[model samples]
Target chain A: MAEVKKMATRDAYGQALAELGEEHENLVVFEADLAAATKTGVFRKKFPERHFECGIAEGNMMAVAAGASTMGLVPFASSFAMFAAGRAFEQVRNSIGYPHMNVKIGATHGGISVGEDGASHQCCEDFALMRSIPGMVVLCPSDAVEARAAVRAAYEYVGPVYLRFGRLAIPVFHDEGMSFEIGKGETLAEGDDVAIIATGLMVYEALQAAEQLKAGGINARVINMCTIKPLDTELVLKAARECGKIVTAEEHSIIGGLGEAVCAAVAESGIPCKVKRVGVNDEFGHSGPAVPLLKQFGLSAENIAEKAKVLVK
Target chain B: MTYEENMDLQRKAVKVRMGIIEGTHAAKAGHPGGSLSAADMLTYLYFKELNVDPKDPKNPDRDRFVLSKGHTAPGLYAALALRGFFSWEDLKTLRQIGSHLQGHPNMNLTPGVDMSTGSLGQGVSAAAGMALAAKHMGNECRVYTLLGDGEIEEGQVWEAFMLAANYKLDNFVAIIDKNGLQIDGPTAEVMDSGDIAAKLRAFGFEVEEINGHDFDAIEAAFNKAKETKGKPFGIVMHTVKGLGVSYMENSVDWHGKAPNDAEYETAMNELNAKLAKLEAM
Candidate 1:
């Protein structure tokens, strides 16, 4: 972990939501028995009337969230990522995405976290699943500060937005003065040899890899790509065109994540650069500590640095 | 609205059935059973009860309606077309490519549609949102929605029911087209929605039982809904599958199957007689 303040991204979501509730009285919230996990329990303590609990039914929770949002209430629904995006995918698309309601879906327990709770709880495909829906704004913040900013951004944005929060308490990445935008990302460390673009918790790993690369005489630029749906296309194109080589990383599947997004942009723009993707391989996660599970899936900082080195080569 | 005027509206429901059949017969495919069951309640609301402006479909002050059971778009399309919200000629374009009348009610694609609801169990949820919006905006306008008896089997619909109860969304009214049949067979055989009124009551809604085809009963129920002091309302309208047609009535096969040419002719003749009677008024 870097020298930064300690905070859980979920807590950031909760704190930011409470502040939004004060600003926009129309902001409502629902949790599928996961208020504590996603940290919306904080909001519930403030405004009991605006908080709804739909039990363990993710499909039901999604529909309720859509209903609430449609009624002019900006609802932020939270649940385990697996349940929110994986199980109730149709509900998310049909109920919330179809009408293009201003609902914010904050999913927690993403990647191989929720460690001992096993693979059924962890979601490595939420970003891909949510991004597939048209008009949906998908986001994965790097740390607590960015997570808070992401919530505020989604609240102000006038469409369905999805926020994927990892279970573990990651270190703070961006500073307070760091500007936040929905589709535009921040360049954490500037490098000229290659750009390592990443989203979610993996942004920290990307930063770490960039630091190591900087020490190894390899100039690597690290980007914190918070938005996944309306991806930072200009940034991606520039990274591919300017840097000439790109390495993408995320705590998700290699097939349909930040890698796929960057690759799509590079392919469409006819940019000639060696593009390498660092993420979970074609294998299911196991019940263990988050770090070991991430290591098993080859999503550690060292792995990202290795891939970045290969891309630069 | 008088007793006589309400009776005349019931006659218009017969016309609604006629329009639904015409649209479906032209399109060669549509769910007719639920449409038949849904016609009377929809007509009663649109013609007299709902505060909608045909000239301005996007009037913010207007009450909203969402047809959650979208497979039965035939009925809603007819309602919108007949109510002067859109050209009745547009009914001919239902479910056809490049036509605004999609297989489902798409708010973006179709004019006068408040919400695009095709995936069953979602329309009710959207209606809940509409009602909540009315409350949040401090608007007096109400929100109305209709769903199939078969569609209630979906868990999301029940979840919406619970939320309505929790929120005390008295401005919302939901109607269920209880035709007792779905695509596979009778809803009872397809996993039984389990005493719908009881389920809705358990979900904390004020329940109204009415014969969906009876205009007087529907009018009375609508009045009752308006008179409701508080709490969200749900009307479990018991209607026969394919209500108006002779051979189609009570036939589960007519749920989605379109009538053949000969059958269409017979159905048209029956509708023409009904329309002639209504026009005479």
Candidate 2:
């Protein structure tokens, strides 16, 4: 057994932007004074002329990005998820979403994984807020490779995109050749006993849970749903029909995140499957180390395996 | 700058004001006060300043204008219509269910609208982005934005001003219509934006004070903005809310209220008389 590589998705985001800057000359980056934190400083260092430091004004940054998008330039505005999605929701909705601007919002430090910063800094509600925007394409990549690929895909897409990244370094399980589509979900493992649907940081946890479930003689299917908005109904419905039972996991609230999205898809299609949600159960996350905090919030492979067992039984 | 030119602009402005009344009267809802106050400048930008073509609205080299106080869509729509961006007859359908002339300026729907801006303080940032993009691409195109005195209260406006100044967007011009009144009441009574010119200067802009409705002042200020270097330009235009309509002038009640049929008739008659006088000049 070899040691698995680990990298934070934010790191991938920065590297992706810098790489994309070379390929796309019209690609511009805007940072709300979180260039180093959000990793946009990488792109800024490479192309100082194309980078815009928008200070700490998240709302202004969003609007400025929207404006740049109108002028045939694809601008990626970077900030903490709390500030980008929570604080500047209206600006995103009206300025970016309503007009369907070609602006990518690179929101890092998402979810309870923003360790030691406490509840205020942790944006557990970003998925919900961004998902509500009519034309916004919400994405939460599971690992470094996926995150990098998602950035390229978002760039190729011709509308507003909200990409959430984590502060904690997670397992980079996917290979470089793995396919990453905007509105499609990838089935990580095949099974028949129960389906474990997951997104963002939880996808790795779900895969681990699937392995644990396999050891316990339970064949669990793992689906990595990176694109939250325009949820892959085809895949969700297929999982629902094949497995007959499901457990959804994410580092976001169960109310409006992956859990609810899955529920809606299954319920609307009249699929006869038992669905259980595994996530932060409508509570704020407190200050702690990232991994430990994730475990405490029942966002670990152990918790996911436990939840999947219930659905399987 | 000639008398005939000024009179021509005045005639166009009078028509723009008439469009505002006509549109608001038909919609039975809109911010006519700010729209009327910004009519002359809107006319000036469309008719004289902006190098935009109606046939080619999306030309990359054309100057861009954003109505930051987008509630004054009537003024912008009128200007766009008169400039042949669209038919003026569509003005009557302003704010209607299916009309492209929305309650707020929607850039996607309206041909000449450079940015969709209704939410206060957001449009100026968009304008700044446009200016920055033009600079980045080495394009000669300039960006202009119109904001209300009341709209400036939003903290995002200052943030945008800071960015514009920090970037040294000399091609950007932010025009604040110092229309005394807002939806609540007079701007001084509600939130005194004390010494807007000084505030703009402090924000590192090359500041200019002008009479908004004065064609000569408007022309001179825009020229000075073009000549200025190393920083963004801010024009603090002293304007009367509801400038053209006699009953609506400086009236707080007209801030967001559409004129009734009789009020509309009176407003149109007054503007028509002004147009007649300008024509006779």
Candidate 3:
């Protein structure tokens, strides 16, 4: 058995940023006074001169990142998702997205797993808000390894990118050398009864659900759909055609996260399938322990298996 | 600065004003009052202060200019066209469909523009960022942004000021066109951002105040900005809402309204007469 590691996606983000900073000298980072929490402190330690402490101003930080891009610098602006996506959406839209600047917004503490911070800090609508901006690439990596790879991919791609990360330490499920491509999904398992599509931390639960389903004599396929915008439509349609039942699990709003994206893709492809969405349903999160919140919000492995069973029936 | 140099800048300012009038008149929907007020400063920067080439507009080392108060695109477009970044004929297409001259400054669409800015108080933030980038790269390229006095009412402007000062961005200059009038009324009535110079100074900028329309004062302020180091510079230029045209001068109604046929002709005639006088000098 492989020795699994436990790490927060933000930790992976910081590590990848430090590595990218070494490889690309033109890479710069901007933060809004949450460096230690957001884990940009790691990169700040390595490259103090390249890190800009924007001092609690996300709007200014966003526009500043846009400005740096004009000077040929790939700037990664980091902050909590609530501030980055909610408070500074206009700046991100007009300054970076409209001009199609080469700026990567590394937003951490996304979704309800930011436990104990309550509704003000949790950002479940970021995927939806960012997806609406034209020329913006929205990525939500499922694990530590994938988060690190997503950072590198965003750096290579020349345009506006929003990379969402979480605060809680999730399991590092995948191997280090697994392939990662923007706008592409990776099928982690194959089955015939149903397909379980997931993004961000929910991929782990979806895999667990697949495992539990196997014991019940119902096989389920698990897939990691990282890129929400520019989604991998061909793979999603294939899953719909093959399995005929799709269940999407995410730590975001059911309105516009992986579920809506998968549903839209399936509907646009003229394929009919039974779709089940498992996430925060048009509601805000309350202060609670991370594990309990997952169960309370129906985002746990057990709940996912139950949903799969109902769909399989 | 030499008298000849000042006179040359004066002539260029007149041409820029003419272009602004022509641009707004042709569009039939643009802000001429603020554009005319900002003509001299834009003219001085484009003609003398900025180290930019029309041939290589995207040269990384060139000094960057951001029109933070972007509704005044006519002023920026005129300066760019006169500086040979584009054809002067295209200046008439301001706000027209398919024209590179958008209602606001778009860096992608316009050749000489360094940052895309339309929403108030945002361009200064971007300009400060550019200055920070230049400082990090150990480059000497400077960044300059023009902001409206009324636009200072936005809280984001103060955030940008704080960021600029905190970063110790010496390679940055912010010019405030204190036109005293917004679309609604006098800025004092709308939202009194009391004492613009003092507010910026409190924010840690090495501040200067000058008459925006005076060529000599404009030259001195920019030169002083260049000499000062270790802090960002702010030049609060006292300016009328509309400088060149008689009817539009200090008029709130003219803030964003384009001239009708009769008024357009009168504004053009006035600007041309000023141009003739400067050309004769």
Candidate 4:
């Protein structure tokens, strides 16, 4: 059996994309001067011609990728989340989302965990912008295991997809051979007292929180909600109905993040439940270490456990 | 087929233009002025030059066409309808709620629409993607896109243009409809696009200036485009805003205003005579 190694989801994305490209020759990749940074350099080393370095021009890179998809070749465009979502938003919206191209934007360096590089590089609003785009599928992978699965899943799926990753290395949550399906949520733990829903780097923290709650004799169910756009409403509703209380966590802003998505789903179902959100408040991040930044933004395992305790009570 | 066989295509162009004017007039809301300006180019491509199958709109091997100036979708809808991609009757449904014919081109809803475009700078970028695909696949199929002169002001269009040239997208032909007018006023008065031909040449294109309505000139430009070994080709077609009718030609007021019953009657009268001559010959 392959031992689980802690890795940045961006590394998983790079590894998985290379594997998929070799398996299906139709898969192509373009890096916006972040090949080594995003770790997509792995794919570049294998298929040099297929990998295009657009030289720091994120907008141009996005447009090129969009053009590539129209020719029936699936292009995975990798860049930082802030630039991909902010710099080339109109291109992503008009060319890919509007036309519904099969272009996957694999954005690394998302959320506040883009620590040390500080606030300017961190993108806490990628989900809000991407989820707002019509016909765009948004995926926030929790760990390397899920991130590898997400890249493969996004390639198989059609239309526009934004696969967001972060800078910090996180422990692998799923088994080595676990399967990932787009738009579906995975239930990590089963309980009836409270359900913990989370995505991206926070999902690992969320799982730890569930364990902490269990130690205190309170049952907590954890769900890894990877796809934010199609948003596994069935899974969310089941949590709201069965557990009757919910705690949502993510390394994103409270507004329009995984928390908001779960809220909208729970509200629309008219199934009343005590719901709490653990996320970054309306404040910018400062220079710090990874764990401290997570704690400061209230996206830590301790924060999730506290929120789960409140919601369950 | 010879030139005489392709002459029937001219008739199709007139019918397509008629569809454009009528649809704009019917909706009482569309840019008929620009749509009429690009009628001949659309007709030639859909009828003669481009190898496209209406039945297999998404076939990987088919040539890709993009209307970068998406405001003039009426022109494309008319051409696609005549090419049997959809029904000519569908022209009546333009801009209506639930109609596939949106104000701008939408690839999802409408058949034969290669990319959805409405924002001024977007479609060209999408075409860039299509051409890039042709390069990767080692496919000989070409990519043809049309842009409005007014739309060239958008920064992204230039960004996309540079990519096409930098990549030496020899398989791409970007046709610019220099119709001299746009919404609100004449394009010169609004935002001067100085010397489109020389500008495009500087941007690394095999630039050609032509009378947009001249079929011979259009064909010649396309041939020149085909002959060029490297670098993308750009044709700057000098055209009138409201091209076909006497009253509407070159008039900015007619840019989007649908003709009323009286004006519609006059347009039909002029178009009928033209259609009659085209059908007769």
Q: Pick the candidate with the highest lDDT.
A: 2
Ranking by lDDT: 2, 3, 4, 1
Error of 1 at B193 (Å): 3.2
Each candidate's lDDT (Cα)?
A: 0.84, 0.94, 0.93, 0.87
What is candidate 1's CA lDDT for residue B64? Answer: 88
TM-score of each: 0.94, 0.99, 0.98, 0.94
Would you give the TM-score of chain B in model 4?
0.96
Cα lDDT, model 4, residue A201:
85
What is the fnat score of candidate 3?
0.83
Stronger candidate by TM-score (2 vs 3): 2
Which RMSD values do the candidates have, in order?
2.3, 0.8, 1.3, 2.6
lDDT over C-alpha atoms for residue A217 of model 4: 95
Model 2 clash pairs are: none
Which of candidates 1 and 3 is the stronger one according to DockQ? 3
Q: Tens digits of per-residue lDDT for model 4 on B105-217? A: 99889999988888887778778778877987899899999999999988777877787888899999999999988886878889998988988888899999999887888
Off by over 4 Å in 2: none
Candidate 1 lDDT by residue in tens digits, A131-214: 899899999999988988898889889999989887888888578856788999888888889999998888898888988888
Q: What DockQ values do the models have? A: 0.53, 0.88, 0.86, 0.59
Q: For candidate 2 chain A, which ten residues in a row score worst on lDDT?
A: A304-313
Q: List ranges where model 3 is wrong by over 4 Å.
A: A1-3
Q: Candidate 3: lDDT of B14?
A: 84
TM-score of the second chain of model 2 compared to its true counterpart: 0.99
lDDT of 3 by residue, A72-98 (tens): 899999999999998999999999999
Model 4 lDDT, residue B231, Cα: 95
